[model samples]
Target: MITTRVVKILYVLALIPISLFSLLMAVYGLAWIDDSAAFGYLLLLASPFVWLFQVFATRIVLEFVINQFKISEYLRAIKDKG
Candidate 1:
């Protein structure tokens, strides 16, 4: 369990570069179609928003998993008490 937690943290950290690349690709695609330098510039400027979205998504997922784990633990404890 400890190792799994460590690996998950590392995996999430490793996604930083992947998110940056995705943001760049998105900006490039927008530039290709819209041909608006401003759009590309704005997308680049909002790169942090993309990262923030990823972080929020990751946090939500982890929170859900943790809540599930805690619920299961509580149920087991209740069963044991009974």
Candidate 2:
């Protein structure tokens, strides 16, 4: 069984890259503002939505992983009982 501390650490690890990528995207978009106004506006506007979708997807994946672990733990318990 995975401990709560380990799960928390995994969650944080998973979020780190995502958060960094989002920040980078925002920065890049800001930098582009001087070159192309329309494109820069698009990126700036889309960055938040992209970040949100990424976060949502990550959450779903992490939940699935955690559920798999829980299911396996439960199966193990059942096997031991029987």
**Candidate closest to the true structure, highest lDDT:** 2
Question: RMSD for each model, in Å, please?
Answer: 3.9, 1.6
Candidate 1 on 16-49: residue-level lDDT in tens? 7758776786767577556777767667666677
Q: lDDT (CA) for every model shown?
A: 0.71, 0.83
Pairs in steric clash, model 2:
none
Q: How much does candidate 2 score in TM-score?
A: 0.82
lDDT of 2: 0.83
Give residue 57's lDDT in candidate 1 (0 to 100). Answer: 75
Per-residue alpha-carbon lDDT of model 2 for 58-79, expressed as tens digits?
7787778788888889999999
